[model samples]
Target: MTIKVFDTHVRTKTSRYLHFDVLIEGNDTEKAQAHARQYLLEKGLTDEDIAQSECRFCHVEPGNPVVAQAISQQGYYILELQGCQED
Candidate 1:
């Protein structure tokens, strides 16, 4: 199966916008955003509403075995591209 890839940008009150490619099993923007929020929480990033902190669908591609595991568990996977690992 294919996945919907959303180009995501998240910024904190005191930090710059961090980039992440959020991959989900479906194309629902709300669902994708929700999942992205959950990811931030898991990473201890933020708990405030992320309504303005999400998604622009960039592409659809074939299945990726690497991300399949995460998608199966949380309905999505995050590809960290820049400034996502620092404190």
Candidate 2:
């Protein structure tokens, strides 16, 4: 299967922006953003904090077994690039 990668930035309540990549099953940016927001919520961030998030389509590529499995189970896979520890 192929996957879409979204380059995402999210501002925390602590006033720091986090950089991460979201890998999902489709090319829809809104769905990717939603998944990113859900991840932040699961990591103890509030909706206000997630309100400042920005997500853009970075690229698309063929999926391997690991990420494919992750997306199948959780609907998305987070690939942290820099500036945060919410992985």
Candidate 3:
């Protein structure tokens, strides 16, 4: 599985979280989601630390390159199974 990571800014009324969006490439949504959760856990993210996020395949066109570059610079494999897929 191949994946990319993007820094995401999530803000609430009280606080903000500097989270990461794990972008996975594959035809299967189930596989992608699984890979993402596992990767997060290995990086020390608890289950509560992750939120289900979706990125439309269409919008991924322009943003793909930029995301790829960022992931490369970060030096994280961004691909590994940490847990089973959730329903």
Candidate 4:
């Protein structure tokens, strides 16, 4: 299972949280989520730690894709996905 991760600059009204979007090739939501969760765990995040982690799916169409947009806009890549929160 190959997964790609990209950084997203997510900002809300009151708070700012860094975002990492994971891109998977196939259209299996369950598998994609599992892979993402596993990746997070490998980074040393306990299940409890990422209970509130935000993840979403993207449906790309011809000529433009959400993952591509995220990478271009945010300048994030797969390597940035590794690592747990440093606090």
Candidate 5:
């Protein structure tokens, strides 16, 4: 099955933004948003931030279809996830 990387961002209470990506089922925005919420929760992000957070696919890249990486504004070394494709 073909897949695409859904790029998005989530903001914390400190007003810090986390740029990340999700491997969605397709180019559906709803699915991407849902995946973003679930992904943040799984990463231990607070519910408040998760609730207040909004996700939007910035763009996609060509490849085996995986979440690219997470970049922090503070320049923190963020771990990259080989995101799994949604069923």
Candidate 6:
């Protein structure tokens, strides 16, 4: 099993967004997104929220989260239909 790590975020308040990192053991991006979606559902987020959300596959050195990098270095490719949020 190849475990992939994802850094996801979503808008909660008009001016605030929540963030989380999830590690899912799977070989496909589809599986990863599904795992994240389920996790968000368990957190009380609705399907509508997930449908309107976005995701990204990021790369960073081990032990370093992308957020720890300088803002200029922290960039993400917005994946389609896959951001997670807590209600």
Please give each candidate's TM-score.
0.82, 0.85, 0.36, 0.46, 0.55, 0.49
Q: Candidate 2 or 4, higher lDDT?
A: 2
* C-alpha RMSD of candidate 4: 8.9
lDDT of each candidate versus the true structure: 0.79, 0.85, 0.41, 0.46, 0.52, 0.47
Model 1 residue runs over 4 Å out of place are 47-52
lDDT of 4 at 35: 54
Clashing pairs in 5: none
Per-residue accuracy of model 5 over 15-60 as CA lDDT, tens digit each: 6566766554357778767666666676767677542455565554
Q: Lowest lDDT 10-mer window, candidate 1?
A: 46-55
Model 3 accuracy (lDDT, Cα): 0.41
* lDDT score of residue 10 within candidate 2: 82
Please give the lDDT score at residue 65 for candidate 1: 88
Candidate 4 residue pairs that clash? none
Report the error of model 5 at residue 21, Å: 1.2
Stretches of candidate 3 exceeding 4 Å from the true structure: 1-25, 51-87
Query: Model 3, 1-87: lDDT tens per residue?
Result: 245333233222323233344454433445445654565456556556544443222223233565566545653323212222332
Per-residue lDDT tens digits of candidate 6, residues 1-87? Answer: 233456676664443454665544333556556655665676677666543444455543333343334222422222223333334
Model 3: how far residue 21 lies from native, Å = 6.3
Q: Over the stretch 1-87, how does candidate 4's per-residue lDDT look in tens digits?
A: 233432323333333243555555445556555655665566555555543555555543332364556445643223243233444
For residues 1-87, what per-residue lDDT tens digits would candidate 2 score against the true structure? 899999998876677778989999888888998888887777778787554778999999999999999999989999987766743
Best by lDDT: 2
- C-alpha lDDT (0 to 100) for residue 41 of candidate 5: 70
CA shift of 34, model 5, Å: 0.7
What ranking emerges by TM-score with the best candidate at the front? 2, 1, 5, 6, 4, 3
Ranking by lDDT: 2, 1, 5, 6, 4, 3
RMSD of 6: 9.8
